[model samples]
Target: MSKSVRLGRGVATAGILGMLVSVAVGAAQADEVVKIGEVAPITGPASYLGKDTENGARLAVEEINQKGLVIGGQNVKLELETEDDAGDPRQATQVAQKLVDDKVAAIVGHMNSGTTLPASKIYSDAGIVQISPSATNPAYTQQGFKTAYRVVATDAQQGPSLADYATRTLKVRKVAIVDDATAYGQGLANEFEKKAKADGIVVLSHDATNDKATDFRAILTRIKGEQPDAIMYGGLDATGGPFAKQAKQLGMQQKILAGDGLCADDLSKLAGDAADDVICSIAGAPLEKKGKGEVFTEHYKARFGGNPVLNSPFAYDAVYVIVEAMKRAGSTAPDKILAAMPATDYQGVLGETQFDSKGDLKHGVISLYKYVGGKQTLLDVVKQ
Candidate 1:
């Protein structure tokens, strides 16, 4: 072919590619589609919780889209994008960057504190609003990030309550703590130790476990010898199940307490009949009364084909909170939503939740729950 003809062919190809690019950009601009990103465990030891969180967020988005997003009446729609961080903090940061690159309007459903903490900074710097449904570490809201928010009680409330039950109720002078060493685990453990010590309970020993650990005989044997009054665990039920069985086999049959991490019916499944005597505390009030959590339960069951795990519905509420803040700000732009979040008060799955100055939930009270007959029964509500 002639050089001029070859050059013309190349130019025509370039023109086609440019047109495709324009079409993509134009489509993005045309959609009044506001994007929300979700990062959850999805594939790791805690995938069950991840799946629940995703369903909650997806359900909220579905309702929002169906209702025709009325933010300034621009004919808005909500588009959901999800990424699996597998409950890893480093992976969570990567996913956060991906969301920022996609230019999502907001994010919800980071289920782990280890993942949520690092990802929060990325959201803060990029001016994206992020609401975590299950991150209970006190430091999560303490980080001073204007964009970070949570819908449940923090571990600061849960840990001490567990400690109180161990000390005052169970009358244990010496105790041991086993933690998974993540932000959630360690933070709650630290609180337990502090409160237990303050209440005149001696901490006999401390141990560590990873999230999916299967063996606890070694730790249980050691704790058994120490003759701790009780053992407080700081991880989720994935590890707590085996921990309970081994503790019973080792004849530690004393009080075993845990935070919200282990407060699920699945935990009862893991511990079997042995879970009956266990005393666990959750970060939020138990779904005890019919009034508060019933609507959320019914709606979630009908839509998601299952029940909300622990506080997964809190994430569903967080999604609405962010979207409502967007409506209040009259913009999906991050800075405006961030500024408007503190003023957002929405009737939600958890309760009528409002954010304090630090963007933490302030409406409902935290309570202590105990396992009995394979069910979580509310023991008491700590009024402090």
Candidate 2:
């Protein structure tokens, strides 16, 4: 063979090898797996809410994988790394660290305000975007962590909405307040107290309770004696249910007012007949009232064999929001996803979502509910 011809053949072979390497690299990129962490109280008293949150995220993951996800010209597969924080702040931090070690691109939970607050620092330090679907304490986002965000309104909005409903709609004159002493419960109670006092509703008494306490006879007895027209309990349905049931057992007919923690689908089962006398507020609009709410509910029921409770819709929306950020950034890196989050304006099951500078929803809604015949009945929806 001629020397020049041999050199040309060698060059052609090198060009073919380079093209093959490029194709292999593109194929590898197409198979990239993006891990998303979801932390919630999946095993403790708030398990009902936690499981709903997991199911929502799980559903979103399944649908995304099924419909196919492509980011930056590469096919991407999503994997959810779900952890149970058990509703404890300490455990939440541990779970957050685990997710960070696992190198997840983003996180969707830490359902309770207490847990979300502690876990947020871990995510922030790791440069992961942490979106809480249900944590409503104003302090959750007020901690100056750029990674922290929540889809729901804060206790600041929910508390005043509940207080206003108690004063104007329920005609409440004197009210007794009780809180579970956790960040969420106490913060909600504080906001409610501030608003209720400002609205001219006399606070007959203010008391504290623990989230795990089952017996409330002593507090109920005192509040009953005060004869307040209404009682506000700042806690979750796990404890609030029993509190209301016990109050009914004690022959107290006063209406019970509470925040989103007590506003759950399981409240009727937890409080029995006393659920009827309970008025509760959710930090977001009723799922049925949102643009894609009915469809999402039907899909959730069909997939999970039950209706969504509390923040499931929000959780599902959070997943989509994260994915939207990935698409906009054209990358699955955690920092890139976090950078895309601030500009998110995606519309999903809960409606349009946009975050403020503090990572709270730009436009928040509060929904009120009352139990009627062992079912939750919507009373009103207030915008904030």
Candidate 3:
């Protein structure tokens, strides 16, 4: 062929190649964006709780995106939509509805049980899958909401375990209970009181307080007179820290027992020297003690510049669970994610996490811990 003809053919081939590259770039830009919602107390007193949980979810989203995941032959990008509930039930419902309206594929939040329980109905009604990272009230899972699930053990298991430890191990004959009047606080206190009484221990008094109360002097003073062997507090770390501080100031030498809410490093900051008096129970095994937990802890600290407060690891796992479901269903539709949730047997930072028919962790773990040298230290792990 002549030089002119060969040059013309080469130019045509180059033009076709450039056109194909532009089409590929257009397809890449059109990648589906999957939004995962997170509802927690990102403001108010429990903002730390919400922030910690959000960090985990954010981290998971980042890690997943880094891998450039593809679902059903379509390139996908995961996006996080976080809402602050201020740890309030009414606010949680509003946030839940907003997320539903935003059309999120799944949600991981409403950190407190009180918030989670009421907000759960909103998610359920809208058919959005919700996996709470904290919220341990047994009623949450027992309500028979197919869309509701939690990654932690419930108060039913945590309460009985704590009661057994007090009666059998601590040998406490008398106990005083104080709850913050929230669903989480009241439920935990009630369950502990029942189990303690059933174990043949004498109950001293059951006191109630609001979660926002700063001065617990009156209730503390009244309970001081009772001289109970141990005082069990049913509330989050925000209140729990101050409660322990006041108890110590009152010269109440009795040990303090509480739930997972008080198991964070900040508890020591809030309680100061009084943190050592606290013995708290978490809904799952101590993350540091788990096989993969230490690695997660290191990664979290490196990314967030601090240790995880409460259920951050679970929150991270919750995000993974949603993604796993998405992968299994080969779609990001809400109904498809819900359908794939029941068969979730995810091996995460916490180990093999399987859900039961009620959307509760099948092999739930309730780990007990105490503050040693102003740091939370794991004492025991109970499988329920």
Candidate 4:
């Protein structure tokens, strides 16, 4: 009732308001951060592919931040916590655990098939959704984990296409097959051998190699002795590079063919003149589409100071795919986002991308690429 009593009440109310403001500030900061996991090879032999894929995830986050985020009427910025897997399956598992511990809503990476398959299981167990940009092993999606997804075509699709091209287009009757013995290499080699033989092409010699091995002179001698018209190699850019150079020196006339893993900027540089005429097929068309692909390529060239690698567009598409799924779901919750992913049909640098129930992108096409002048060029899109 008195002036002092009224003044005392005012101070108490102001203190209460300040406390509420402090709590609100803490909550606002919490809502402002959204973590996205990115695991890839920042170092090691597979760094080229992993770093390129990492760039896509990074670019998406940057674009999403610049444009502003709108999720459930709350503004948020995507935060990327990138981990280096070193292209090792064991390291991939460790990275997956680290991302789960960090509480990232989604993951992108562990580029190699060997790493992606093993790491995906850990992510699935942790309820984290991961979309691999370049892992093409058919078993990846076949694992029945709804949280796992990929932007690139699987080896099942690419293998038959590569084999058909080798038989029908290249007109090769006798072929030698070599696989790196990893999930991707073995699966692709098996498919190509089966299909090539069915197409009346002889599987003259079949050989296996370890990914870590640098010496292949014995294998090259064996392949040369077979006198095959063509060589179908199932391996990464690292070994493929050396094989190309060695095969050329061995006086082999067989044209070398390989899958997406063999396509890399560093691979061409390693093989030098030996990389010429190596008919390597890539997972996505890096130069076919103009808008997004060109922007990515320009940025990549500026950053890396050379032409963009084959999987660059696919990596870019992987980001677009995940972002579109999140937009459609209106939530970054892993289950909801993965469910909504099947409905996302976005036109990206890799073309129209739509996922099936098995977490595999339907309507996907693998393009045949050729290395000319030490530059990988998209030759044709094998639509099936």
Candidate 5:
């Protein structure tokens, strides 16, 4: 019971503490890092849309990291691997292979249907989970691949709903249709054409143009001769905006109908004042009223310096869903992520997100929007 005995006890306690600290540091260093791949048109005309989606995913990653997520008893850090698909199917497949080679845990992109559909096969074969934020083609989900999924409604619902709105609500009898000649454009336009015909609406004309064509004057001039009550354009804002602008130049007063691709805030800037005459259908609930709308909007603007496009919320949700699946599976392997996808019921910035058996959202909501006074406004939300 002297000073020597007390000092020996204190030294022993200090040594134990140092060993524990070293062990803790080693565990932290062993934390697993998972990479999530995002393939979108980060360049070219659709770059804005791609950047919007990428921002959503990037924000989600940052928030998750800040929250100090622990999965499978290990601290996890998520990294984003963004690749530009240029809105091309071939480029999408190339990036898909590259992501597989890079051994990403999952993917949250391939923005357009044309790109998403083709690239999906590569992910499927590689056992990588591919969740499209904006691809709306029903065929993308109908491919029977377990690795494929989407956060938005399909053109199957969006096209018919828009057609019904045109015929019953707007009381339009004659309709003209135009597409951008890509899978997404043609598919949505075809669906609208069929539904419009079945709803007793006369289809005055159907035409085709590429997605990059800035000159829609020729097509608008031809449609002007038809004198249609409404014109449905199955393409993205890049092309749809110019089409609307030219339609205005030709003095066509008919209301413009478009699919989710054209449902963006920048449509007003792209189409100028002609955006007021455009009514577009998006494949999800309005962002401002869903899950964490206002907060997400403020955060997204602060992070990306732009308004949310049609698919940003969906992409945000897609990232959360992937991480949730990773938590459930207790691993970041591609096969495990794909296996956990079918059971996803994630509450995200968008809303309750649950996938059906075919990897499609169960309660897919379609909303109609129109630009009024140079601002995009929601008209209706249709659940399908």
Candidate 6:
């Protein structure tokens, strides 16, 4: 071959090899794995709720992966690391530490307010974004942790909504209050008490109970004596269910008021016919009322083989919110995602989600529900 032709062919060969190497490097960069942590009470009394939360997050991750995700010009695959906190604060902190150690990009939960509060400190210290799907205690955001955020309305809004419904709709003149003594139950009860009093509904009595207690006869007996027009129980459906059933057995004819914890699909099974007399409030719009609520429910049922319980939709929305933050930040780093969170305006299964300075939802909605024919029926949706 001629010397000039030989030199040109060699240069061309080197250029092709360089191009191949660049493509390989780009392929490696595109196959990035992003880990997300999910902590919930997956084992103990609140297993049903925790499992539902996991399902919602898992579904979101699956959909994202299937549809493909590209963040910062890099293809990202999501992996969910789920841990069971058992609805305990101590365990929740431990789970938070583990996720931090594992270097997850963000976290989706620590379901209950009790657990979420303790876990929030760990995430804040680690500079990771922690989004709680169901925790409603106003203190969760009030702690001034930029890392903390929630999709639902706070007890500050929920309690007042329930109080308004009771005063105007139920005409509850005198109402007795009870709490499970956990942060969630106590915080909600306290907010309700404050609002109920402001609305001129006389507060008859307030009592404390533990979440594990299956029987509330002692408190029920004391409450019955007070003859309050209504009874407000601030706790989960697990305890609230039996509490309502026992109140009926004790011949207490007053309607029972409760917060989101007591509002669940299985309350009818837990309280039987007594479920009919229970009125409750959820800290967000009814799922059916959201823009994408029905479609999300259908997709959820198709994937999970049943309807979503309380907060599952919220959990699902949390995942999308986190992913949207990642897209906006163009990075999966926790700090970047946290930085992008405050300005989030993603619309998901829930309506538009935006956070205030305190990481609380800017436009929160509280929905009231009642039971009829052993089914939870929506009464009203109040914007707060």
Highest-scoring model, lDDT: 6
Instruction: Summarize candidate 3's per-residue lDDT along 138-246 as a digit string, tens digits.
Output: 8998888999999989999998899999998899999999999999989999999999999998998998998998898899999999989999999988898999999
Worst 10 residues of 6 by lDDT: 22-31
lDDT of 6 at 267: 92
Native-to-model Cα distance after best TM-score fit, residue 114 in candidate 3, in Å: 1.0
Runs in model 2 deviating more than 4 A are 1-30
**What TM-score does structure 5 among the candidates reach?**
0.91
Per-residue CA lDDT of model 6 for 1-384, tens digit only, reads: 999999999999999999999767655655698999998998988899899999999999989987889999889988899999999999889989999999999999989999999999999999999999999999999998999999999999999999999899888899999999999999999999999999999998999999999989999999999999999999998999999999999999999999999899779889999999899998998998876899889999999999999878988999999999999999999989999998999888879899999999999999899998988899999998
Residue pairs of candidate 1 with colliding backbone atoms: none
Q: Indicate whether candidate 4 or candidate 5 has the larger TM-score.
A: 5
Residue-by-residue lDDT tens digits, candidate 4, 1-384: 999999999999999999999767644654657788888788988777777777777766776676777776667667889999898889889989989988887888768888899998998898777888888888999989888888888888888888899888899999999999988888889988889988999898889997887888999898888888899999987888888888888777678889988866556677777777588776655454557677777766775676655555666667667777778888877777767776878987676788888888777677787767886667788765
Worst ten in a row by lDDT for model 3 = 22-31
What digit string (tens of lDDT, one per residue) describes model 5 on residues 1-384? 899999999999999999999766744765887899998898889888888888888989888876777788888888899999998888889999999999999999889999999999998899899999999888999999998999999999999999999998899999999999989999999999999999999998899999889998888888889889999999988889989988998899999999988888878888999999999998988888765888899988898887777677888889999999988998877888788878888887768899899999899999998888878898999998
State in Å the error of residue 139, model 6.
0.6
TM-score, cand. 6 vs. native: 0.92
- Candidate 6 differs from the real structure by a C-alpha RMSD in angstroms, to one decimal, of 10.2
CA lDDT of each candidate?
0.82, 0.92, 0.90, 0.80, 0.89, 0.93
Q: Give one digit per residue, the lDDT tens place, for model 1 in 1-384.
A: 999999999999999999999766645554487899988989977888888888888888888776667676566778889999998888999999999999998899588999999999999999988998889898988989988888888877778878877877789999989998888888889999999999999898888887768888888888888988788888888888678877887767777788777878667778876687677876665664537478778878998788788766776787899898988998888788888888988876666778888877775466777777777777887743
Task: Flag clash pairs in model 4.
Answer: none
Off by over 4 Å in 6: 1-30
Model 3 misplaced stretches (Cα beyond 4 Å): 1-30
Q: What is the lDDT of residue 239 in candidate 4?
A: 85
After TM-score superposition, the amount by which residue 53's alpha carbon in candidate 3 deviates from its true location, in angstroms, is: 0.2
TM per candidate comes to 0.89, 0.92, 0.91, 0.88, 0.91, 0.92
Instruction: Write down the TM-score for model 2.
Output: 0.92
**Cα lDDT for residue 231, model 4?**
94
lDDT of 5 at 15: 97
> In angstroms, how far off is 192's CA in candidate 2?
0.5
Q: Write the per-residue lDDT of candidate 2 for residues 1-384, one digit (tens) a residue.
A: 999999999999999999999767655655688999998998989998999999999999989987889999889988899999999999999989999999999999989999999999999999999999999999989989999998889999999999999889889889999999999999999999999999999999999999999999999998988999999999998999999999999999999999999988778889999999899999988888776999988999999999888778889999999999999999999989989999999888877899999999999999999999868999999999
In Å, residue 119's CA in model 6 sits off its true spot by 0.7
Give the range where candidate 5 is weakest over 10 consecutive residues by summed lDDT.
Answer: 22-31
